[model samples]
Target: MTDRFAAFRALHHGDRPLLLPNAWDHASAAALAARGHPAIGTTSLGVAAAAGLPDGEAATRAETLHLARRLRGLPALLTVDVEAGFSDEPAEVAALAAELAGLGVVGINIEDGRPDGSLAPPALTAAAVAAVKDTTPEIFVNARTDAWWLGVADPLGQALERARLYRAAGADGIFAPGVSDSDTIGVLVAGLDAPLNVLHRPGGPTVAELGRLGVARISTGSLLFRAALGAALATADALRAADPAPGAAYPEPPSYVEVQRLSAPPGAG
Candidate 1:
């Protein structure tokens, strides 16, 4: 546990911003791991939508746990996205964190966004972070503040306050999603004691730019999942229009035999 925790900690450095690619399930995670990504994060939207549940509504707790358990067996480090811990109660959120730790999860992203586009109280979120650290001491608690995403009051002030509270409560990192400005990101990184995690914005700053701005981690955060959804729609439309040149081409997928081998009985050839 110490080694795994150390590995996760080492990934967040001043020189390199950890580009964490978010995955939806086993296949996506395994494929990313196969491609040599050091770590993988599960997207809450992906998990909830895949299970026919709405994201940020505390409706996919079981599905998120199950996905985390499946992802923990893979080669890369696994970080589960527990949407606001799936509950308002701090102890319940801690229990969820403990369950994730028991499943060998290395990190967790707990957001402060409500179902109605509001932010959770900072005190409640602080208590949740404290409880998780007390219960699962080794698991990295990335306290996320969606001030910008939810359009909360005074984005910077709100995020900084929540981040301070969370850090005091033993959060390992502070994630301010939907913040892409270099100056703001630099300020946040300079002000916070814990590592700063920013969402990867397309056409925004590059990883090098983020690293220069002192961002420790950059997450895709459902962008890939959403892009996949869009690609699927485009592919279907192109095929219907009998124009194969309108969409991106994909490589030949694995056969049944190879997929079956992935789940072959132990010691069977």
Candidate 2:
């Protein structure tokens, strides 16, 4: 295996967009890595909900750190989604980034989405990005914009402005979630100086389409984790409703014992 951090960074600029699949736990991440994913990212929603914490509320800092420590030993490069950097203070966010870097994390996705479904002040987010980069210059900072996700009418303008500020603040990439239309995607791909990371939705353009439009990265941000949850529920419902029994065996679901072995935390096996 290559140096995961350096290899992960190099994967960003290849001819095709890096189809980054976000995992919620060590098993999900390791399973994906076993299937040949070069790098793995933690989804904030998955991390928070698994711990019974609310997402986007900055309530998962400890959970996030613990997950990072567990995931650092995985076979693939690891990137963590620190929702809104977990605070408004730049120094606090930077400190969190430094800790992640020290734990062998190579990349981070910090969003501007707030707990109230709005965006944080662009300046504040940019400051946080700069602080993180300053503290860990080698760590990949992916500045995320939630303009379209929050129904901001001027999404293009907001994304462009935030992208500019974040790039100036040393962000290595820009993630514009909820942006899948060809026109807007094209404009953002052309405008941003950094690599553009878009969320891949079911009805959205294919990977080739995004690559044709010049997108550099495609993140399945919470989509896979949520889909996995939905799939499990659907299987259970089908089995419950079936007269005899539905064919929803669900592959035996790997076993609790196997899960324990895969995710033995940092110590205490």
Candidate 1 residue pairs in clash (backbone atoms < 3 Å): none
Best by lDDT: 2
**Count of clashing residue pairs in every prediction:** 0, 0
- Candidate 2 C-alpha error for residue 137, in Å: 0.4
lDDT of 2 by residue, 1-269 (tens): 23766787788889899999999987899788767888888999999999999998999999999999888877788999999988899999999999999999999999998878888889999999999988888889999989988998798999899899989999999999899899999999889898999999998899999999999899898998998998788787877778264543554567788666666644455
lDDT of 2: 0.88
Model 1 bad stretches (over 4 Å) = 244-269
TM match of model 2 to true structure: 0.92
Q: Write down the worst ten-residue block by lDDT for model 2.
A: 243-252
RMSD of each: 2.2, 2.9
